[model samples]
Target: MTESTIITDNFLLSNKKAVLLYHEYAKHLPVIDFHNHLSPLQIAEDKKFDNLTDIWLKGDHYKWRAMRALGVDERFITGQASDEEKFKAWAEVVPATLRNPLFHWTHMELKNPFGINSYLNKDSADRIYLQANERLAQDEFSARSLLKNFKVEMLSTTDDPCDDLTHHQQLIKEGYEIKVKPSFRPDKVFMIGEPVTFKAYLKVLGQKAGVEITTIASLLEALKNRVDFFALQQCSISDHGLSTLPTHFTLSLAQEQEFKTFLKSDQAVFSDPDAFAGFILTELCKMYHERNWVQQFHVGAIRNNNPRMLHKLGPDTGFDSIGDYKHAENLTAFLSHLNLTDQLAQTVVYNLNPADNEVIATMLGNFADGRIKGKMQFGSGWWFLDQKDGIEKQLNALSNMGVVSTFIGMLTDSRSFLSYSRHEYFRRIMCNLFGSEMEAGLLPDDEKWVGEMIQNICYYNAKNYFGLNRG
Candidate 1:
């Protein structure tokens, strides 16, 4: 495709009404990236990339997975290849990613910050590389500057409980324009199976929280301490990444003693990992409720499938896939356990498996106790489900089973700075969905009414839901 034709102003807007909704309503809205994997240190330092690959390719498993699929060597994907070579390797695979979201995302990223609209391929790779590098050399392409260019009003970076959050503190001290808050993610606290790792993690977490974690009560105290510390940093969100919600929600007295024994002994193995995790998770949710924090659960990912590659490249190196874990029963038990106690915080549940779309969507209604609009949210399509088909299916399921208007929308869930284009991509797709229905007269012909709802889904809903407007 030519430069002009590749990504036009109306790209993805299927009809005139779609075009109007996108251009007039959704196009210029500032992004509230409530959840992402962006590096806080990079933002705090306002780091500038030496080249496109330095910023774009490094730590991007999505591109690495695509590169691996095309038989690109590991050296180019994640190994010690030169940045230029990696960029070329990625460019060579871009054309092959035709129907993939990467095709659109790669071009959209190139079009936006770099302003390179030409399609990336082997022939054009060198030219695009030089052009993009020229821009990267400029001060405008720095990490913080790029966020400004994307009009990101606020973003929450996923952080570990043991982290000191010095970068987040630095950003605050400097009075950065964008709101960069940390979300407490204590997934490691649930890694009871890896006894040595779990014990070591507890040591660090205890030191960080100024508590000695020996029993279940101590563990909860330490976690609560970190939650309080994160709250001091303006953190109102906590996240958990699990294969599925634990089937067991409470610990029996015997099991609780077993956990205590296991924590003390080096060789004592905890018998029921699920019950132990559930006990801690249940307590954490209650703490989140006490602090009025939003809790996010990202479930149904079977990670590190390729053990050989995992051993070679470490985790988050494109070795995870969607899992088919039974979510409904455990999810219901977990949520109900909290709801019964009135401890259910504002929750967003994300399922990686597409099969669970309706499962999650409908589950949102089970406990949305009329106090909050979209209190229980079926989170936007994530991980393996962040593309077009997955996004549409998620939207369709939420619309069919729950209220779509109050839905807080898309997040990058990405490690790359360039991934902000995903918000624009989502806006166009969302506007098209609403605009097409407007044309068909499915609801109403009033653009003002419909456009306001479109704007809510795109921006306002999340702003209100997350209480970002208050600050």
Candidate 2:
């Protein structure tokens, strides 16, 4: 039998054309998934999967985007199609997905899981698909089982404050070995001027905290109560998905209080969306620092502009595009406000547009205070850049300008369970990068050290950064 076609060579260490590195170093590193969208409920239940396509292609806008790029129609992208048909469509698109990381990842998933050597295409789709579906039918391919299979040590799920986290609580009660924590995302809570939606969220928060949020102070108090609740449940991070860092302008407590008054008033226009948005982001960041939690800012995504899609599908449905903003100066202004303050917490900034990668990567170094190591970070190339070119470019920029050793690795940022294939995709890309570097004689010929470095970027940095320990 032929061995599966691995994307990178295992023995190509340090360009010396010698020395096979032990793959053991790759095996032991713990995964610190600092950002992701994995379902906490499925994790809590350890639910098994029925087939590969259901997990891989369904609801994955990332894959959908690529499939669309390949001329696959919306009927297959988001329409009602059988799982098998979708798989076949995806398989048909697989070979053409070349020069795209999905092609490599599809093969990686096949080799790593099913140990199948055949490439996914029209000719091989049926046999390969059936074999994987057979494996999925077994109990081992469940959600939690998949996490364990990929050696995910820590997973941070993005959640809104309206979430009750009953599932998170259940996972803790069962003492699940993996660390599945919540990252507080309060975007909806801060949209106060929009009466219909804001009032609804206020009610949700108010009901959950059992507080009457009639004033700005009361609203903050309600949010604080929820933050405390999340803390008790092992959440130590707050995530902000904003258009940019909050503007440096600060409202006086009295002025902010008055804004709350405006929220309750019927005269406030829903236009000029940032009135409450800017105020709430500033206050939330302050709260983040007060709690000494690591705050993550995933900024620069221009989302949901397609009216037709927005009307039908809702957010995160592939309509979001990269924004071309002045990220550096704005970031400098935002950090300048908090850099000297004692309330400043460790922060990570991820840019959606890769052209800004070098700019943001360098900007992070400017804010590092020697007071704490890794006080600031340019987060991994996210969203569209999660692919091979994306990860490689991020690694190069970070390694050249900042320390790659301090870098934390990949996050799924996905809603689908099969997206864990991303970890495999990331690992192979990392291994190939390191292996190719070793072959070029630019780095040392020490396989063990190189392997460890690869593992750290793939896993260890995130594990230690989040303090998620399984031992």
Candidate 3:
């Protein structure tokens, strides 16, 4: 009947007694997004999208997986369906997504963007969808507008060594107001002998760096050149996505040569994946040390084996599943190996399995050594846990076991522009968590004190920790 109240002055700060405090604390804080999957090219080009669907729906595996789990057909999720049809299908699935985080996030997006609150389903689908599409057609909904609306002051985008970073350069030249920096992601280089994609990467890296990648030494040199190129473009973070921690190992010169020889011979190292992974991770860590960069380990994900779905839809199309990882002991050993030699970079550890949250959170403090205020961090509630419940739990775990002031706030970790709503979601959850705590007397009742905590969690902490905005 009427427009939904999108984001009220106190929407997230709804616990009336604490509402004033939240508003006072969170309103003017700057955003420091240290890790995400945002595309630097879009920010550089200051591109405008054709419509809302392309910005919100395309390239979001989190939404794609939810749609798949709701039994929406692949055509709507990943195939050639028209935007209207896809939105309609998504509308039908929205109500059924109750008790899921998607339920809340979808409504939030709809309410914030189109000012609609009626449930998205068969009855209201057409009217609501058309209005949202009309808003998308307006000039105010461009990519730059979206970022500014979300108050995204600083954003980091995941990048690969083979990238030329023309987009990053363009963004700097154009003098856009927001900060968009690249973070190196080197998973492709380590997928060697895995029977999937390393060979292709070899050819590409060779072409980009002008080197023969037949030997591990040459490959390292090529990767080094690319890293230098990225650093010149202002990239100061590196991300590693691995299934486990690297084990202790000393590679003899002969062994190193043998592994390089095996690669040239096209022999499979899948049988001994751990040893190779260990060596590669060790080498990558040494590179981080040399560059004085922050390193991120997004570990414990098992991915891309579903032949039918992967072939038809492709990687990150919802074929990834969580694994039971023995991370605590192995991770300790791995870090100890680096620590013993003083070779560890400023590191943040992100875990996927919820069961390991406590272990991961506590394990980080074990490596703190007071060298850096928050040297080893339990990264934000990732993938499956990027919601209200997820964010709260992560905040509690970190607050109770470690220092929350050292915590980095929300990251898109998304490939879509509209996914910035995730940051809003996180900020809301942070406000609610702190607000409720204050109400409960678990924390101080003073407005200034509690407000500082909220501001730290939402923005200030990440800014200080990441050394952002020095420019």
Q: Top lDDT: which candidate number?
A: 1
**How many angstroms is residue 235 displaced in model 1 relative to the true structure, after the best TM-score fit?**
0.5
Q: Cα lDDT for residue 270, model 3?
A: 40
Q: Candidate 1's residue-wise lDDT over 1-471, tens digit each?
A: 555536889998998889988999999999999899999999988999989999999998998899889999999989888999989989888889989888999889999988887889888999989999988889999999999999999999999999899999998988988999999999999999999999999999999999998788888899989999999999999999999999787788898788778878876468999888998999999999999999999999999999999888899999899888999999999998999989999999998999999988998789889999999999999988888888889999999999999999999899989999999989888888888988888969888888898899989999999998898
User: What is residue 341's positional error in candidate 2, in angstroms?
Assistant: 1.9
Cα displacement (angstroms), candidate 3, residue 300, comes to 2.5
Model 1: how far residue 209 lies from native, Å: 1.2
Is candidate 1 or 2 superior in lDDT? 1
Model 2 TM-score is 0.90
Clashing pairs in 1: none
Candidate 1 lDDT (Cα, 0 to 1): 0.91
Q: List per-prediction Cα lDDT, in the order shown.
A: 0.91, 0.75, 0.77
Q: Could you give me the TM-score of model 3 versus the true structure?
A: 0.93
Q: After superposition, how far is residue 465 of candidate 3 from its true place, in Å?
A: 1.5
Please report how far candidate 3 places residue 71 from its true position, in Å. Answer: 2.9
Error of 3 at 401 (Å): 1.5
lDDT of 2 by residue, 329-448 (tens): 778877776765755678888888888889988988987778765778788778878887888898899989898877777777787665666765666566667767777787787777
Candidate 3 accuracy as lDDT: 0.77
